[model samples]
Target: MKKIVIPFTIIALLAACAAQPTAESTESTEPTYEAHKQASWLLGRWENKSDQGNLSEVWEKKNDSIYIGASYFEIGGDTVFSESIELIEKEGVLNYVVTIADAGQGPTAFKLTKSSDSELVFENPKHDFPQKITYNHKGDSVIAVISGKQQGKPHQETFAMKKVN
Candidate 1:
């Protein structure tokens, strides 16, 4: 009886080892998503500050593809400059078409590459503005640096922002 039990245990262990998956079989090509109920990425307020010490913007998105932003300046002790057109982000690019009553210098197209959670290469060719924005999550700060030339002249500006509730 003892001899039979030892042999049976060895056989069971060998069978279990054989049943394990190999490296190739364990790997899957399928994409997976986890539902994040605690992190409300789209339900917060965001803003940016200008290096000139007189300009800034406040932005928010409600529902799907409905983004609204406002520009605030300290021209004379805090003034509201203008609000931006509604926008949407898909894939890795942000697309915002021109809309009536926007505070831009003109009817501008807003496009930004959402590189990461805290970085974007924002451009408004219609307004002839181009810049890169970098953000720090812990500090809730976004730094904006303009690039390229405007109307045949170099365009440059730096801005920062803090996340608000």
Candidate 2:
């Protein structure tokens, strides 16, 4: 009877330990949409006019996990460039994807490397040009910067835009 009681007690202890929730399990249960909520401020229309061209970008929240954006550049009332962008959160990872149909290349995806209330940085080191892209949000303006190697030389571009709508 003593042996049987000892075995039963050990089994009960083991079962109790197994039933407890672990730190990793609890962390995995956290809502992924919470991370995406941080980017909600980007939902709007932004425009910039300069000697280079007139640039316009429109961002919209498609759902909890996806944000859609369209960017276009116009010169002399003619659209010279345009691209579609998507910010998607998948399995807790955020990706910035850009597609330019006339570029003759598939969409490029940049992983979110840094983020804050007023800034977001995405990077794709393997890309030929523009390995890093950053967006800094001010009260009613956003400054976007792209930097990388172009033709074996360091290159950077900045677009300072204000919220239009």
Candidate 3:
């Protein structure tokens, strides 16, 4: 009886230990701040369909809750326009606020209308851009289609980007 009791206690202790998980083992499935920054397609350089040339944006972290990036457009070997994007998130929703620094336009704020693993859309009635920028994954490249308005007419620009360190 003593031998049986001792074995049963040992088995119960082992079972309890197996049922418990360590802190590292219970890690979150969601992306961290660094991962979120990396997951975004806006992190790298892009080109317009026209002669706007390569637009590179460097992302800077603002505290623990915000990210800021700037973009400049060039044409004919000269800088034509420049802009800044401020992105923030709370409760899984991303807010994109764009400022046309060089164009002298006020800031426009947009909300995340739709999103997926490969695509995200930011739309605001007051903003110019409506349709979401679709990022489709190719073999080794990402195709970004930015659809919006240019002089009250609908227009779309496709940009292909390769992730570089």
Candidate 4:
């Protein structure tokens, strides 16, 4: 009777272990293509002319898993500020990467925290400034908002741009 009971207990433990979910089964199975599709609407050229300067952003789909973009601010036909951007999907996670031209620093990566058909939010809490970035797309316009702590104080900036092409 003791031997029979021990065998039954071992069998029960083995069954319980088999029933538990594995990490691979629990992780997201979403494909990179599907993730990129969610952001396909951002493709095209966007421009904003303000008293401050003329800002332009252009995006292009590089492949099924990547989108390339660039933004620049021009004053009197000279580019004053510019940055290169890459939206990539890897391992079912989306990342927004930006490199400021001539900043003498490597690119910064922001992970996608919220996403919808018309709005996307990326955040990097460890970043010094603009820890949160959001893009809201309307019919023919897009509004980009960046907010975070600047110099130990809260700060935010908004850019309203219209699709030009």
* Candidate maximizing TM-score: 4
Which stretches of model 4 miss by more than 4 angstroms? 1-32
RMSD of 3: 9.1
Query: Which candidate's lDDT is highest?
Result: 4
What Cα-based lDDT does every candidate model obtain? 0.52, 0.92, 0.65, 0.93
Tens digits of per-residue lDDT, candidate 4, 69-97, equal 99999999999999999998988788999
For candidate 4, which ten residues in a row score worst on lDDT? 29-38
For each of the candidates, the C-alpha root-mean-square deviation to the true structure, in angstroms, is 11.6, 4.1, 9.1, 6.0
Candidate 1 vs candidate 2: the TM-score winner is 2
* CA error at residue 147 for candidate 1, angstroms: 2.8
Write model 2 residue lDDT over 1-165, tens digit each, in one string: 999999999999999999999998777565467557777778899999998789999999998899999999999999999999999999888899999859999999999999999999999999998999999998999999999999999999999999998
> Candidate 1 has what TM-score?
0.51
TM-scores for every predicted model: 0.51, 0.80, 0.58, 0.81
- What C-alpha lDDT, on a 0 to 100 scale, does residue 93 get in candidate 2? 83
Model 3 residue 125 distance off true place after TM-score fit, in angstroms: 2.9
What TM-score should be assigned to candidate 2? 0.80
C-alpha displacement of 58 in model 3, angstroms? 3.1
Which of 2 and 4 is the better model by lDDT?
Answer: 4
Instruction: List candidate 3 stretches off by more than 4 Å.
Output: 1-52, 129-132, 137-140, 149-153
